[model samples]
Target chain A: MSTFYFIAFLSIFFSILVISAKNPVHSILYLILTFFTFTIHYILLNAQFLAIVNFIVYMGAILVLFLYTLMLINLNKESEPVKPFMVKIAGVFGGGILAVALASSLKLVAASNPVILKNPDLGLVKNLGKVLFNEFLLPFEVSSVLLLSAMVGAVLLATKDPKTA
Target chain B: MESLTNTIHAVPLNHYILLSAIIFSIGVVGVLIRRNAIVIFMSVELMLNAVNLLLTAFSVYRGDASGQVFVFFIMALAAAEVAVGLAIIVMIYRNTNSIDINVLNRLKW
Candidate 1:
């Protein structure tokens, strides 16, 4: 229980840092830390396959891509324009409203006692693989197609015609 | 492992809900406040992660694998999103030499 609290605290802190950091590189680093804490949370939930997948796909691929783009673009703190104070205040106000609404609504939800797992191996990769391949095969195949299309679309969008320019 | 689940259950499920809600709110604030396009993108990722966390919590509580499977789908979708989204952002930067979303106001016909 203490460990969950500690991990949750670290994740919330790092998420805040990801947004508030002046340097884009620093923000990316903080985002990685946030992902790490999330990975811990997944492990605690006994979703081992997902915990590893989250670590590899998020912290490994997506964040590295973000970092590379930031570096490639060479964005500096000085180059980032500042928003007005009113806008910042409004943002905070909007977020606070959402937080209050969500928190308050949660109180109405009666906490149901979680069913204790008879076979704790449900989240293990072997078990997940069976469930994924057998029950969710259609979505699994569809997502692969989605990924392929996304890759092709990204390449097409990013490439330039030198002659046109 | 059994003891671990017990300990986790000792803490009410509402705590996880509140935590994810707070994180989601922060992401919302970040998206609204940040001017840089990349930062806004990061905030979107933060929101997605918040949803993912909530899904995992529910999955654990119910002893269901479906929620976790959905999380896997969400991750895949997020990856696809980032790939295309960042590519578009890069293309925008190449065209205007700036990634500020405000600069794209020409589209606001």
Candidate 2:
């Protein structure tokens, strides 16, 4: 119980740092820490397969890609463009409205009783694989196409066109 | 090994919902306030993850693996998004030498 609270606190704390940090590199590092806490959360939920995948995919692959992008862009001499004061206030107000609405709606509804894990091994890779292959075969296959298209699109977008200039 | 689910049972689903709500709002605010394209992109990732957490929580409590499966798909989608997004950001930098949202407003002009 205390461990869950502590880890959740760490997740929120690191995520706050991820957003508030001025340096992009610092933000990415903190985001990595935040995702690490989430991995712990998955473990707490007994989702071992998802936990490992989140750790590798988020911390290992995606964030390193972010770091690479930062390295590609020369951020030294160029100054960051700051939003106007009014725009900042508007943004805060809009998000505040959303949060308030969600909170109030939550308060109005009676929460159902939380259930214990009836099958402790439900989250294991074995069961998840059974469920995935049996029920979600199409989406699973389609995701590969999504990956291929995304890869091709990224390569195409990043490369300079020979005919343009 | 002792099962952590017993410990997690001490925490309520409402608490997870609230925590995810907070995280999601923070992501929203980050997206709204930040001008850097990469930070905005990171904030979007943060939002996706908050939903992911909520889905996993529900998955565990209900003894259903479907939610976790969906979470996996979302992660795959996010990876693809970041790949294409960062590539576009790099292209933006090459073309305009700036990754600022304000500068990106006039897309066709």
Candidate 3:
């Protein structure tokens, strides 16, 4: 339980750092840390397969792509024009209202004490794989198709004609 | 394993829900406050992750594998989103020499 609190605190802290950092590169690094903490949260929830997948997909692949783009573009503090002070205040106020609304709604949820199983292995790779393949075969195939289309779309959007440029 | 589960269950599920809500709100603020397109994109990812954490928590409480399966789909979607979205951002940068989304408001026609 203490471990959960500690990691949760770290995740929140890093998430703040992600948004607050002036440097986009530092924001990306903090985002990586946030993802790492999320991976730990997955493990704590007994979702080991997801923990590993989150590490690889988020930390290794997606975040690295973000870093690469940021580096390629070379955006610095000077390049990022600051938002007006009024806009900043409004943003914070809006976010605060959202948090309050969500937290309050959560309080209304009737807590159902679930039967905790001893040695629940649902998060194991073997178990998750079986479920995913058996029950989720269609979605699995669909996701592959989605990935293919996304790849094609990205290539199309990024490619430029020499004559046009 | 049992001890770990026990420890996890010791913390009430509401705590997790609250934590997720807080993080989600932070992500929202990031999106609203930041001017950088990449930073906004990162905030959107943070929001997705917050939902993922909530889903995983509910899955644990309900002893359901479906939620985890959904998380799998979300991750895939996120990967695809980042890929295509970044490509578009790069394209925009190529055209405008800047990644600020505000500068792209010339489509007022």
**Candidate 2 ranges with C-alpha deviation above 4 Å:** none
Clashing pairs in 2: none
- Compared with the true structure, what per-residue lDDT tens digits does model 3 show for residues B29-73? 999999899999999999999999999888888888888999999
Instruction: List the candidates' TM-scores in order.
Output: 0.96, 0.96, 0.96
Q: Which number leads on lDDT?
A: 3
* Chain B TM-score against the true chain B, candidate 1: 0.94
User: Candidate 2 iRMS, in Å?
Assistant: 1.2
Ranked candidates, highest DockQ first: 2, 3, 1
Q: Write the per-residue lDDT of candidate 1 for residues A113-143, one digit (tens) a residue.
A: 5434545887888988888998999999999
Better of 1 and 3 by DockQ: 3
Which of the predicted structures, 1 or 3, would earn the higher lDDT when compared with the native? Answer: 3
DockQ of 3: 0.71
lDDT of 1 by residue, B18-96 (tens): 8899999999999999889999999999999999999988887787888889999999999999999999999998888
Pairs of colliding residues, candidate 1: none
The residue pairs found clashing in candidate 3 are none
Better of 2 and 3 by lDDT: 3
DockQ, candidate 1, vs. native dimer? 0.69
For A105-129, candidate 2 gives per-residue lDDT tens digits of 7888787566467788888999999
